[model samples]
Target: MSAETASARLADIQSRIAQATKIAGRRADDVTLIAVSKTHDAAAIQPLIDAGQRVFGENRVQEAAAKWPALKTATHDIRLHLVGQLQSNKAADAVALFDAIHSVDRPSLVAALAKAMAESGKRPDCFIQVNIGNEPQKGGVAVAELPALLAEAQAAGLPIAGLMAVPPFEVDSAPYFALLAKLAREAGLDGLSIGMSDDFEVAVTIGATHVRVGTALFGARA
Candidate 1:
């Protein structure tokens, strides 16, 4: 995308966020926009950053690793977030790269992060993935299973900042997103990763601290 095109798209997105926040009776600044730049290249991302986007989310660890170095050097200050299912084997590399992780769905991943964080001397903020839709095909702990998982993570010295979820693809998502926010409050968590290109306004309405927006900002991935 040309810089002008990318700038216009980003401006539209920010305007939507402002409108949504106003309707929701929340400050627009309350919502942290995470540009979901998973499939896009640094060429595409740099312009977005130059236009004043500081946070970006990536779905794969290796892909993020490959893109971050160049983007980091080019952009003055940027935060890389891992917003996808993170494997245990990638824990060390993840700790080295992301500023936060929004897919801590298993105890093993927690343990792996704890070990990796201690070993690498880094503590990347993290969120527990709650499978609000309870889809077996999705990657997250069931809602009913969260308390136990929270306990285990706390005991393991994992630094959990909040909860993350991808609502069912083909259903109304507001209820599910609200449910996750309620669960996060009950668990005393701080972050909510509950929005994407399709439903970010609803997410903001329902109090999502972080919204992962891709196509809405940079157009659909190629």
Candidate 2:
């Protein structure tokens, strides 16, 4: 996409966010817009940075690794968020790569990441992924099991920063988002990585600190 195209798209997204904030009686700053830049090329992200977007979300370790080298020279203050389930084998690379890891679920992954971060001299913030809707295919700890898992991770000295969830495939999902927000608040979590392109406004209305938007920003990915 041309810079002009990206500029226009960003303007539209900002307008949408402003409107959502107004309707919700919440400050726009309350919701952080994380542009999901997983499939897009490096050149495509420069325009977004030019438009004052500092945070971007990526889905895969290898894909993020491929793009980070180019992006590093392009912008100095950009923050990269890894918004995918991290395999234990990839924990070391994840430690070296992202500013925050949003999909930490199991105790094993937590232990591995803590060890990896310690060894790499990099301590990235992390979130416990909650399988809110309890879908078998989705990767997250069951909501009921969160407190225990978090306690275990904390015991292991894993630096957990917050909680993340992807709502069920075929549901309203607003209630689920609201539940996650409530749970996070009760747990005193500083981060809530919820929402996507389709329902980010609802996510914002219900109090999402970070909303991951992909197609709305980068357009449809093949």
Top candidate on lDDT is 1
Q: Model-by-model lDDT, in order?
A: 0.91, 0.87
TM-score of each: 0.97, 0.94
Best of the candidates, TM-score = 1
After superposition, the stretches of candidate 2 with alpha carbons farther than 4 Å from their true spots are none
What lDDT would candidate 2 get against the real structure? 0.87
Worst 10 residues of 1 by lDDT: 67-76
Q: What's the number of clashes in each of the models?
A: 0, 0
Q: After superposition, how far is residue 91 of candidate 2 from its true place, in Å?
A: 0.7
lDDT of 2 at 190: 73
Model 2 per-residue lDDT tens digits across residues 38-145? 988888888888887888999999999998867876788888899988899999999898888999899889889888977988888888999999999999999889
